[model samples]
Target: MPAHIGRPVINLGAHRVDTDALIEHIRTTYSDPDEHPRMGVWERIIRNAGVTQRYWTRPLAEATATTGVARRAETAFGDALDLAETAARRALDDAGLDPGDIDGIITSHTTSWTVPNLDVHLVERLGLRPTVARMPLTTLACAGGAHALVRALYFAQARPGARILVVVAETLSTIYHQAETTPQSMIYRALFGDSAGAVIVTGVTDENADGLGPGLLADDPFELVLPGSRDRYWGTIDDDGLHFESTRAAARAAADSLPYLTDWIGNRAVEWVVAHPGGPRIIDDVVAGVGLDPEKHGRHSHASLAENGNLGGAAVLDVLRRMHDDPPVSGDPGVLAAFGPGFNLAAIYGCWA
Candidate 1:
């Protein structure tokens, strides 16, 4: 009795900003005496990020405005809701189902802080039944999307014939702060983008459910959290907005987790790999860590990163969507992997039906 995950539907922000333009904008915005000297360094980092373009919920100019955090949070709140609704609706439609069919909802968001969470609002916006079970995750960050699916698998297994909707949305652009002159902030501002993605997971009694979706096998998923690695990547709330704290060691930490990853994967043949596009180095680490053939399985994750930049938890779903659109040979086994703030690595093995 495996749960099936529907094809994911992704919705990127309205504006697509060229990477070169973004670098130039960053230079102009931080042209103060104290920050002027580091413009060239920032430029180098931006180019090395391996992203040519990324979408933003609002125009770059508006996003980089000197507005206070209150205003930024306010704007992000509204935009997140709109994107969440769009992706969720599209995902439901893609599964050949309606809102009423969804028995549970799972949402993952890290870009903004809100009391009621996106799940509550999404249920209303999409006209779902009020009694639908809801679980909203705010802590997973980049790993949230894959983790959402893992959680959905658990829910589906617990209640047979359950239909679950998973939505992951991030407005990283809203967290860009011109006041922060640190290299971590600069890299985050240049590399991150805004996007939303949704998927439907249906629990079925039969393992060979016809065209139900990609089956998340009954096998247990894998997770690894490095001890005391919390400070390697995180965000802090200040008057301006959320400030990112990322260290060079973060990439090394990702690579270091390879042994644990290998142990969890065991002897499974991973024909396809869905990895979170943390950055060039992180992707490289994952490829090496998971022992994947770069020529064969690496393109999907790299393509997702190049096109959408890093959408945080929404990234893995984007990659999964691409695989669904083109699809691999039926019954090909695949693996989904992502890393987030807890210095956590989460992976799930599945097969296309």
Candidate 2:
């Protein structure tokens, strides 16, 4: 059985943060020359990230303030679970299905460190059956949504008549620690938001798998990790909180994986692309690497960045949601791609159905 993914529902954070306002606040707060000697580079990176606005699950001040690991973890997990529940309920309604219709649950979250992950909490809150299969992915970051969908495809094939619900939620705004002064850290501070997204994958007959509907059915899924590139992005512990860092080489990591991706794409005529809105460069790299028409495709990606910054694990689903809003021609061939901490790449080859 082939699996057809349904349209997703998104729930955004309540606290809106404007890029211009954020820029002003950072300038004033980190004004000491001795502390931030290279403030100019940091400012440029933030400005060039192309994020006009984003939202924080908590107040902007608290999200950026120096806080202990335990406090940050508690707050981030609380907000993430709330948003996830809302998105899951909306997704069930969108698919015209009940909570019992879901035979399996897949959740991807990485914003906080905690035991008894979001999957079990969601299962309890949504009133799902205790026997429903569950898969929890905790560290994929921006690639979480794409990876979950990849897993759902196989789950559908295995169970034949199964229906799987995939959920992704992230409180990335919690990463904004004022203790970090690197240019990369500044770019990250400007490039993330808090959000949750959920969608359903239903097992369908072969005839219904390759045609036009509201979404792309899963036909093929691919992943790649570049050699010796593990350090492109990583995390560390500090007195303030968990800190995510990106190397200067990280800017080129997405494009660097293109050769392997293109080899997989082969002769497939790609009519569209759903790129993760990690930043301006990531989107541009997709457009360039895949030979997509810059004037037309990947608009959803750029739009997501401008409207909501980066929603971490929820970023790709938001991109897919925009694709659903203004749909493509029936049966259009496209690829979904995202990058994460391991310098890992995940892509799905599918067509509009």
lDDT of 1 by residue, 1-353 (tens): 66787778889999999898998888787778987888889888888888889999999889888787788888887897899899998888777888999999999988878889999999899999999999999978899998888888889889987989999989989878777777777778777889899988888765436657553443357788878888688778877876668787776777777788888888987777787888888887787667777656768778888888999999989888887777777777878889988688888887777
lDDT of 2 at 271: 86
Candidate with maximal lDDT: 2
Q: How many steric clashes between backbone atoms does each model show?
A: 0, 1
TM-score of each: 0.95, 0.96
Error of 1 at 43 (Å): 0.9
lDDT (CA) for every model shown? Answer: 0.83, 0.88
Model 1 CA deviation exceeding 4 Å by range: 32-34, 213-219
lDDT per residue (tens digit) for residues 60-140 in model 2: 777788778889989999999999999999999887789998999999999898889999999999999999999999999
